[model samples]
Target chain A: MDAALKKNDKQLTVAEKTLIDTNLLKRISNGDQDAFSELYINYQPRLIKYCSRILKNDVALAADIVDEAMIEIWRSAGSFSGRSQPSTWIHSIARFRLIGYLRKNKELLQDESSEWLNFKDDALLPDEEIVLSERNRDLIKNIGKLSDKHKEVIELVYFRELSIKEIALMLDISENTVKTRMFYARNHLKNILSSLDLTDFG
Target chain B: MNKKQLKKRIPIEALKLLPWYATGWLSPQERGYIQKVLSQYPDFRSLLDAERKMINVVREDKSILDKSCLDATEIRLNKVLEQLSSTNEKNKKASKGVNQGVLVYLSNLVSSCSPKMQYAVIAAVTTVTIALSFAFVAPLLDENNVYYPATSGVKKSNNNLTTLLVGLNIEPTDPRLLKILDENNAKIDAIPSKSGMHHLTLSVKLNATQIKSLLKTLRDNKALFWFAGEEF
Candidate 1:
């Protein structure tokens, strides 16, 4: 079994996953259906969460967008220059698809704004896990309140786990600009979280 | 160094990097500086700790969806890819123009060449031992391996030397591809294999510079076919 398949180890390290994904992508380029299936299964959750965060409260649409993005991946598998990690490339596709989905459903998003913070729950999650999830939801709600540019940087850093250079590529900006945006985003997040703690809900 | 210099607080730029450092975004040099500052300044250490906790909080969404979402996604994906695969031949034609967006993969083979390396690459391409391959390095075969000054014609038979693992979806005889190959001094031989795939082999002798030029040429072209080999 692959290390990622071991019972107590559901998560693989970034390097391990990147190595595995890179090999799979190469195989996928050769019209390997099995390799494409493996990529879909591995990336399904992260991309779902990413789209969920970006579009906010649209799980069905998020799922569709991610599905569309995967198909795009299958078609574009040949052009993948090893410039970014496979995961980052996957996220970039999802991000573009998410933008289109968002534009298509802008009105629907505003209608669901109240329910945007309601994340799906799992029985397997513990009490501390529930509290953390709630905190994450609150934080993400505040993230939605940020300027679009600031929100993008923070989301890319925390959700996508992209580095400065990767973020630069995705945004078509410079690495220095990425750093500056990240600095402001973090500061804004700090203020928002602090303010959240002082509200009546706190 | 004086005691005051050693005891000075972390600078503002270093402080600004705390969040980036926590997120593993800093360059190695910046990371090292932040680590040194963290060791010396307890105040900055606490800020770094806060940043770590915040990032952890941001990343804490361990929510995996129910089986229903999975089923839905798989069903939809199958519907889409099945449609795509049925029309795969048609899609391959369109895919060439679709991926032509300005973003090229930022590989070191294209971007990091020093001026001297660039000069050497030009010298090599002009000299053309060009295997300009889609895969691995192979030796130049017989009198057939010739660089065209638009005068020397190519050997057309199975006589061309073959390097295995040239991967791209387009057929070897695509007009655009033939144009690209002719423009350069490279050729591809389409070998049918038992694997139900076009085991297209890029045929030529690879010198260092020709390999680099081939990479640049392939990258500069807006076509979607990608090769999976690492840089030579």
Candidate 2:
């Protein structure tokens, strides 16, 4: 399995990977099943995380959403204009589907409000915190303390490793808004860490 | 001003972009600028390391989806793919329906024309169609005398080769079938993949009357030919 994965990776450059993805979409547009399967394996993990977050950690629901989004990809691949990165295009489709699901279930309203309410100041007790690396654990805890808007930018950049432009395009926000959110989220995370006596963590 | 002072001096914009820098998502120019800043303020290197560590920590929390969920997703994806295939086939059939609609539309348009104009248009279309057909068919017409399709008269040429799709009554390997075709100066050009059919090329440049005679000759041999018809 490891050898197969390494062969699959092939360690292509980012531009090469994007080019391959664009080519795959073109093939998918022509109803190529093998191309769709290759794209599915490449995107499943990240898409699961992205959709799971938006759907409030409902991994099963996120997988269903991912399936629906993949179906949309297969349907509309011919319409991909290649203006944006393929990753941006695919993530935008997943975001649109997830938002649509939330709106349909009337969960968007509750989700927005509950997102802030769900931020627990005490993410881990003192004893539980000792079980993990205090600095890494504190950083994760503090990141969770951020507002949904701010936390999204942080997650997109730090965890997903998306460019500012890509995240802006995916979220339908300006690049300035993405940067500003990251800025505020960073400061807010720092303050939260400082208050928790993890000031020197950074 | 020592290490603490230099660390404090790091730009807020640079700090805001540090996550992207650590993740290598920044452009070359932005990365260069960040690298310059980090070089000038060596103490800020710790912050960059911390950023990298922070990313690793966040990515380490892989509780989002398990293997079972992903396996289920693959099954669901296959279902979607099945639906997509059937949908595509339906779409192809619907597109054919659209083509048929276009033909109906053209027919209606033809009907809207005056009788004389319609006749003129039809005549023009028929002329063009026949001209195109002949133009395409002319290349296939070799030195061999070309036979038109069933119910059409044979076009005689110098070489009197007539191709016929003959259905055999007896087994193909039967000697009587070869004897009858050999008597008529016809040889099997190709044994068709379909059952009961063979392409016989008759080298006797026969005219319409002679072809009729040949047909009668084959019909007389009930043990050999079941059905025989000329094809181009």
Candidate 3:
């Protein structure tokens, strides 16, 4: 049984994932419409969800952000460097497009309080795992208290699974700056969760 | 090492490194530093644990995002494919039309040149015949006092010859004749005929030299003339 489980667990490694994604990117770069379509089908759902979370569950706006990001992916797929994971690279693209959408429509972001409440309620319910539930509720609440910059870093690096280097490139900031924002964001979350009585939740 | 040194550490300013640390992404040195610090401070140990949990929660949320985004992307891809197909069709039609137009224009051009060349050859032949006829016939008519067919009843009376009705057919419209008449200070009576011909009765006294000069000028100018006179 252990051997069977181990075999099942031996899925594609990170390097293998990167290789496959890179191959797909290379095909896309060569104007292979089928390859590009495959990429779209593979990543669009994740991108839309990321945008929705970042943009505070504005589904229509999230859809627009996802569309814009995919269009950019289509245009710039030929330039994909194997320097990062394909998902990380694509997450960065979605983040950038989401920020632009938010900035362009500031009023939508201002009305995001209701969306944040929904996100917080929904976030707390997804994980039945005790540790995950406590941590998720703490994060959602603390994220609402963060500055836009700090929240952006946390969302990209932690939530979106982008590396510090990838986040730096996408935000057009230094790696040091990304680190600084992340550091403060974590500290802030820790303080916020501490005030919420971490033992009671545990 | 000292509590003073530890207090001054200020969370490594590189606490930014914690996100990478939570994900087990740190280099050995960085991880060692963090571990050394965490061992020294029990509070930091708990903080690191909390940070890892937070990162996990975020990762879970992100995973959900992945699935939804892919669904949205499928719809977008379909739209793009539709647009590309339409553009390809339009481009194909445009190219076909351009090719057909070019072929038709070339065929018409090739066909048109032969007829145009034929017309040009006919025009050139007609021009040359006219030129030669004028050169030969003009001098002969001018010397013989001939009346051109286009003019009738215009006559020149010759004193040395019998008083026969000597009708000299000359083109009254000719500039050379008009100039000659003007030079001699002569007048002629012009009568218009129904056949678009003009009849002129000359009233000028002409010596042999003047008559010869007038004939030479008319011949040089290619004025046509003919004789319509009483038969002897």
Candidate whose DockQ is highest: 2
Off by over 4 Å in 3: A1-11, A109-202, B1-74, B84-232
* Candidate 1 residue runs with Cα over 4 Å from true position: A1-12, A104-202, B1-74, B89-232
What does the lDDT read for residue B28 in candidate 2?
92
DockQ of each: 0.07, 0.10, 0.07
Model 1: which residue pairs collide? Answer: B131-B205
Query: TM per model?
Result: 0.31, 0.35, 0.30
- Candidate 1 at residue A184, lDDT? 58
lDDT of 2 by residue, B126-230 (tens): 899899878776655655545433322223433546766565656666788777767877788445522234777777667878777676666556456544544
* Interface RMSD, every prediction, one decimal place: 17.9, 23.5, 33.3
Interface C-alpha root-mean-square deviation of candidate 2: 23.5
* TM-score between model 1 and native: 0.31
The sequence of per-residue lDDT tens digits that candidate 3 reaches over residues A67-129 is 677767766786565555676666656654654454344444443432331122232221122
Which structure is stronger by lDDT: 1 or 3? Answer: 1
Against the true structure, candidate 3 has what lDDT?
0.54
Question: Which candidate number would show the highest lDDT if scored against the true structure?
Answer: 2
| Tens digits of lDDT, candidate 1, B115-210 | 888677667764564545412223323356633222112222343433322334467788987876676555665653322123334566555575
